[model samples]
Target: MTEFDRRKFPPPEDEAMLPWYRGIFDCGFISLHPFFVIEGLDPRLNEHGTLVLEGKDRPAGADFIKWMDQLSAEHSKGKELHGRSVDHMAKRFGQMIGWGEMCERLGLEDHCELDAALRTHIKGLRDDLTDPEAADRMVRHCAANRIFLPVEGDIPPLFEAKLAAMFRRAGFTEIIAGDEFGDDECIVPVIGLDNEKPWITRDDFPTYGHLRLMAPDHSMLAWVHWDSFYTAIFATKERAASLDLDTTFEGFWCAEETKTFWLTQRPLPLVQPR
Candidate 1:
């Protein structure tokens, strides 16, 4: 796992989610699909009384993610479907999304293009979801969100110590470390990118990092949450807003989606292990 790269971006003091994401971009997590997708074999409407997908009987966003993830599942039975790749669709719709444009830029263009098979598949899937006449071909997780932010860098003794202290003081319910958990989940104060390979690397992150959050919305929420969700933990939004954003942001990145905007957005890492 990589240590938080403080020199590349902002510190962990910002209240808005934007700065945190910026920090992640500095580490190299590219936004492929702005929307996290999910697919469910069974479907049900939610409290929103809207279309729903089947799952482990969890949050609405989970259903949405399941619905969208089927980039190929829509063609399972008597169906044929396709659409843009998750990463490609994410980049294409980056304009409508908040931090997506930034995420797109930070990622490398190598694997960032619309994939061939996945591309064709998503196009069909999108159309089906857009206009579903039957049931089984139902797509669920269609909520758009920015999830991944790869972190790379040597650990800074000072920053590491500070965050370790913070987590220790918070007495979180969970802690994590190492590749399995760290690479997939854990949040970091700083993240670095392998712009050359265009993949995210991790210094510290682990499974069961409780700081990892899901999107607040169900159907309108993100798919995997991609270790990139945050809000004012305790402080009110106003209180969080009063705080500085620059001090915590990671800044611009070279995105793979578009040649125009710079990518930015990072995860807030978990300092301890569970």
Candidate 2:
């Protein structure tokens, strides 16, 4: 059997953000896509169920639910029950079971008459799910919080090498390249700002900084980032040598920490010859 490599397959167009490079002098800032979770990151953004949903292999949600109910009934008959049965039941449901079903399954207490309280709690959660005002409030609440940038995807080590070349062009000569942070391998540099305002804190120069290079035609290429910020901006302009420049419409979502980037190695139109 052939091995499955998710990186080999192109992701859905909705999440597409490919990047390419010509030379160190010609690089751009990575931008944020609208589909990016501005509110918060979805932790399970890239995962799947063990069972394939096709033909005889298809798993039915109702059948799984009924199976759990049967187990509950069996336990009630004074039969010896496994202490960790609920763990197994939860694992079986995985992604197929809906929210309400989950609540019901967990609410099955052995001796406590807490059914009414559980129902009330579930009702409140469900109401929030449908309430437009509540939805707005949630967004507002997230906005009010002072921390964290949601990571869209990881930037592969190969791509990191390309970024290093761009950083060299931007006069970041002193670099500390290591894998100290485990899977979060990074290449940090000591870039002297002098009179230029620092985008990242001096203490954070080892982990975060921006690199902006200008092309012969006046086109601008920039890798923008700051300490304590979630989003890193990679921006490119048609002409950086000229006073007036046109901005490229495309944006990318790259993370330096994760092992595999969701959108990896797809060719970008910007890398093609004019």
Q: lDDT tens string, model 1, 178-250? A: 2322235443332221111111123354323222221121001011121222211211233234322222322
Residue 39 local lDDT, model 2? 23
Give lDDT tens digits, candidate 2, residues 195-216.
Answer: 1222222343334323322222
**Cα lDDT for residue 48, model 1?**
11
**What residue pairs are clashing in model 2?**
28-235, 29-234, 29-235, 30-233, 30-234, 218-239, 218-240, 218-241, 219-239, 219-240
Instruction: Give me the candidate number with maximum TM-score.
Output: 1
The lowest-lDDT stretch of 10 consecutive residues in candidate 2 is 43-52
C-alpha positional error of residue 77 in candidate 1 after TM-score superposition, expressed in Å: 9.6
Kindly provide the TM-score of model 2 when superposed on the true structure, using C-alpha atoms.
0.20
Off by over 4 Å in 1: 1-52, 55-72, 75-93, 96-203, 208-210, 213-230, 233-242, 245-274
Q: What is the C-alpha lDDT of each candidate?
A: 0.26, 0.28
